[model samples]
Target: MKDGLKQRLVAQARAEGFDACRLCRPWDVRHVPERLAAFLARGYHGQMGWLEERSQWRGAPEVLWPQARTVIMLGESYTPECDPLAGLEQKTSGNISVYARNRDYHDTVKKRLKRLARWLIDAAGGEVKVFVDTAPVPEKPLGQAAGLGWQGKHTNLVSRELGSWFFLGSVFTTLDIETDPAEVDHCGSCRACLDICPTKAFPAPYQLDARRCISYLTIEHKGPVAEELRPGLGNRIYGCDDCLAVCPWNKFAVAAREVKYHARADLVVPKLADLAGLDDAAFRERFSGSPIKRIGRDRFLRNVLYAIGNSGEGALCHVAQAHCEDADAAVADAARWAVLRLRRDANGLE
Candidate 1:
């Protein structure tokens, strides 16, 4: 009966658009508590203080739900149709990470998780819970324990079959299901991900310092990005994909099956000049359904100004100067920074 239910759950998961599905016991991620404590102790989470706020539930799934006997991990692939690094070549444009180039995965994955949980409850008469990335839930570690993939050096799950271009969703249920063996790390000698980080965010092979990470510094971080790290960000206005794109394991990745994740041509290599001009209303309208919308207009423009500064185009200097007195101090500061950098480059000081 347990075996049959597991197969049915996998079928339902794929039917609902998940590309991969696997199972694990609730207590499978045994080392997470101490690992998380160490990471927080080092202040590696940066401005994401929420990770510390919910450490107990995130650190232990069994403690999160003692009644839960099985965890169903799902992977939704969003592999970019082109080289994810292609935007970096077009310095005039901003590099929005492939993950944020479409509708927010939090909304997409949540509905699917709810659908699966409902089915599980009806079939086996057990309670269930669903989680996407927003929760303090340690989805990556649980993903590894579920035989979905191993946590690569970049600290994100990398699947041999799905590569690094996927999102994770989990369904925890009171129903016990047959468990799959955990995946073992395959990142032996390859430093592809570690070497690709522009900000040297990785402290070691499998450790990361979120303070210097472009993704966190751009999105989760408040205020202007640290001046020292701004240049390394280049034109990556949203999240950074350098490490994910450089993974050799992604050679096996296929095109994204979900039509919603297909890149909007306008968003693919959006001109930095155009983005810098977006006011609050225009920003909301432009990024209506995008993951980028959550950062709000001020923070988004702050990132745009930083990119404009790094552009060296100098042609964008006036655009930066125009925003030098933006209503938001961070935006104004970023604008001033961009103006200075561009003016410096104009004077051949760059």
Candidate 2:
């Protein structure tokens, strides 16, 4: 009966829009505690202090919910239709990461998880809990344990089938489902992800320093970024996809099945001048259902100012000067830096 149920669960997961569905025991990620400790010890997490606060539950899924007998890891594909790196060349436009081009994945993935969990409860008597990156659950390690994919050198999961373009979600249940064999690493000395990093965020293979990562700086971080790292930011205003975009395995990736993951017309190449003009209300309205909204206007403007500074377009100096006295200290500092950089560029100070 459990075997039959597992088969149907896989079918249901596919029907619910998940590209991969596999199961594992809750305690499968044994190496996580040591690795996570090392990452935190080295201060690699940067401003994401919440990672340190929930160490116990994050390190051990068994302790997060002791009654769970199976962990079902799900992967939803959000592959892009075009090269994500193309926008970096558009100096006057703000480049957003491919994943945030449309609606927030958390809201979309969680709703699917709830429906799948309900179906499981109806088919078999068991309690279930769903997580879509909102909890202390170690989804990536658990995904590898469930045979979904190996965690690549970039520290994000990579599937031979899905490439590096999928989001992970999980359902933890009390039913004793059979677990799949863990996936072995297939990175095999490929350095594409490491070489493409503008900020050298990776110290070594399978390791990442979030402090120097543009995604961490533009999103998770607060205050003015370190000036030394500003030039590497380029025109990216929200998140960076350098490591993910350069993976050689992406040749196998297909276009996303969900239309909501596709790039929106305005977002594909948003003008830096237009973005810089957005006030708080305009910012909120513009990014209404998008993940970029979480950063707020002041922080978003700070990122935009940094991008303008790196653009080498003297024309944007006026935009930067307008924000020189912004109420937010970080934003003001970023504006001043941008003005100086643009003026220096105009004076041939390179």
Give the lowest summed-lDDT range of ten residues in model 1.
1-10
Q: CA lDDT of each candidate?
A: 0.92, 0.94
Q: Candidate 1's residue-wise lDDT over 79-103, tens digit each?
A: 9999999899888899999999988
Q: Which lDDT tens digits does candidate 2 get at residues 27-142?
A: 99999999999999999999899999998889999999999999999999999999999999999999999999999999999999999999999998799999999899999999
Query: Which candidate number would show the highest TM-score if scored against the true structure?
Result: 2
Number of backbone clashes in candidate 1? 0
Output the TM-score of candidate 2.
0.99
Candidate 2 residue spans exceeding 4 A from truth: 1-3
- Which candidate leads the pack in lDDT? 2
